[model samples]
Target: MTKSAEIETIAADWLRRREEPEWSSADQVALDQWLKLSTAHQAAYWRLEHGWRIADRIGALGPEISRPFSLAASLQTRWKRSRTAAVAAVVFALVAGSALWFHQRSDDVVATASFVTPVGGRGSIPLADGSRIELNTDTRLHTSVSKSERKVWLDQGEAYFDVAHRADEPFVVYAGTQTITVLGTKFSVRRDGDMVQVAVLEGRVRIDKDEGIERPRPAIVSRGDIALSRGEATLVTAHALGRVEDGLAWRDGRLVFDRMTIADAAAEFNRYSRIHIVIVDPVVADIRIGGSFQASNVDAFVRLLEDAYGLDVRREDSSIIISAG
Candidate 1:
């Protein structure tokens, strides 16, 4: 690496350590001395330090990206895995999320989300390749299109993708610890605190973890299947195709509830809306919720709760309180 590159990389490592909140006073003193060694060192250090801080801020607010289509979609029309320039392009597309977010904003808001698609504000983007992306509310994706491959890094929340086939490039979406690759596929990706849920509505896709420590075990999912990945990239479980379709029903603005808990249903609702739902009684949380409700109509859901089970819905400061009558 060049001298500047070396300095920047070193500073980045140290900054990462500093973020741990466990750095000793001696470590802090050492960092101060390193910063004072020369003007070049200080400048480079500040640049990287600022970069790390911005990344942390954005991470705290959730991923500052809109989940785009899978990389596999753009690379090949037929979805035959070719580990060539396509992988490089996919990696580049992965970074495109952060790149678009950075380039579009003034340096002042470099790490902050200037605007977020609020809950219930559904938007769609049509790519040059005829792929369509339906972004849910509170979803943030840095939008940019390029020749190599279409890429969008899903920073947070959920988005449904219907990718247009591109033989030379793959349409890929990266979220948290998981990466979803697809070609001419329809799917929904939900990125929660530490888990990523992927359901394929059409076509075949590969779900892999973002780890090189050990090559990930691949989970090949066809249409009508769901894959849940937790902890690491290791597959936890793959459910039946019908179950996958039920969980991914939100793409069509409908939610399919099959013996799910009220608490779990509320959690799912929270994903598409900013409004919070709190089940005051733990017992109420366990109550079975079935049938479909308009994903955006939380009020109707509240009314449904009242009518179906004689429960009460009271609004309290941005939170819907659910209590038994």
Candidate 2:
């Protein structure tokens, strides 16, 4: 995490702690010492505290937002009276940036690009800097590349990044609450809210938790490393390099399942198509299957499930419900 982000996080934590029921004298002493360490620390904490106070009135702003949206009008109307202009900007970022992104913010960005893939859709972005990013099904990514710094944000879904080697201009990717720094390497980041998985196919990448923004620990899989993270713990075992290649089969529009559970397979297939798959029977879900199938071909997969395994298959609108008869 950047120094600015770290300070913001620490300030938030201090604010939260002081408000707790068991907050002690020692905690206040520590906080005082921390604030005394730097003026930047004091500035961030105070601004965040003021914003925290303003946040309570956020719900009241709803009635006013019903008007046809005007970016200037909204920011002016809401923050015109606020003492700290910085907190207003922060509030607009965290609380209202989505609306801004969709409406006006995209045009304001310099040397930046935003891309998205619809449901069952796929896309690719080739940056001016020779770095390439492939967006998986239903993914959203934003990038800003300049001579001095290279940064990208994975707002949603999964993506494969083939970063061009530039030691001076490090490639930084932010996904969920994790920050990945790579000088040059091939890696893929998959995000589902707070859970993120980073798999490196070549070179190395440093993964750090951006505690100010989020707190989920990500599982890292280096070349020849197999990892399965559960809760706060992760299990990593060495595996053949070829096995890692199998996971990237999605890039070729194929879903490769190696003894994967029926439920898990269903979830994987669902990512590529709008047609949902629901495994109704727990017994049937536990059954494992393996294959390399076209991601968009759900019918073929269900046929195998029914004819090969003799499992019950029935359709319910958009869902393909499976059960053990």
Candidate 3:
């Protein structure tokens, strides 16, 4: 076999070894040593690892398909025959299964692109520089990249950003009148009409007023910090990173509430479904709730409310009414 093919075979073998139930420290050390030998070795291993992750996501089909021709088994068999062909086949399968993912990545690379997600839709986008943006429900955004900087305008709604680190060309996000600047960070920006919220999950970000006659002093927000802005005034507050992450559970198709009011919770649920949750009684609206729920499973949430809190639930054609029992 050619030298490149030999390398791929070795990488594929390493990947298979990782799946073994008895993987140990010695194996990890050996793999690390092999990866240190050359950049090509690292690249090949990463490619195989990425494909393996994709396969794992596909999981099992039926009994027949699962037993005889599972993705893992097919990959191993193909590797023995031809490593190049195996990689190509796995990549093709992943591309076919995740067309939307590839399309979003392509959109980010295109110069000056616009993206919109419907009321109940969520999506992830990858930028040309390897950064990723996760759009929440009912989001609208525009992106433009230049030699000097990367820019995004959050027209409305929310998005979580995993920025690519580039010291020379900083990444900036514009939400309403606030502008968030970062070098390399994981952050989220949410715009609710006149109010804008910025939360940093990792690294640091700077919040400033957009260019104008008199710009307010910029606020330096670091990890676990949240910035809230309305008009020209901005407030920066420190928060637990875990709590911040919980607030961003929408990225994983969940909504997490911590002692939040029923009225506020219903407003959040409304963002992810066509059937609106309405509180018929003022006392019911003030009821506090805390839990993690699937974003799109409004029925499950309503059932929880009815069963746990003994609330009366009335389902309408386009709305769900909740009242005191």
Model 2 lDDT per residue over 57-136, tens place: 54254433222112222222233232222233343333223222223233232234466676766555434345667778
Over 4 Å off in model 2, which ranges? Answer: 1-109, 211-221, 226-240
* Per-residue C-alpha lDDT of model 1 across residues 239-291, encoded as one tens digit per residue: 46777777766666778899999999998788767788999998899999788
Query: Local distance difference test, per candidate?
Result: 0.63, 0.67, 0.73
Off by over 4 Å in 1: 1-116, 143-145, 236-239
Show the lowest summed lDDT stretch of 10 residues, model 3. 95-104
Q: Per-residue error at 17 for model 1, in Å?
A: 58
Candidate 3: tens digits of C-alpha lDDT, residues 1-325: 3366568668877876775668899999999999999998998788778886654443332222221111222333322333333354353333222211111233132135466777877655544355777788888887655344477889999999998888677888999888899999999999999799988899999888888826647888889988889988888888667778888999888999999999999999999899999998999999999999999899999999999989999988999999999
Q: Which pairs clash in the backbone of model 2?
A: none
Model 3, runs deviating above 4 Å: 1-110
Models sorted by TM-score, best on top: 3, 2, 1
**How far out, in Å, is residue 98 in model 3?**
16
Per-model TM against the reference: 0.61, 0.62, 0.67
Instruction: Give lDDT: candidate 2, residue 314.
Output: 92
Weakest 10 consecutive residues of candidate 1 by summed lDDT = 106-115
Let me know the TM-score candidate 1 reaches against the reference structure. 0.61
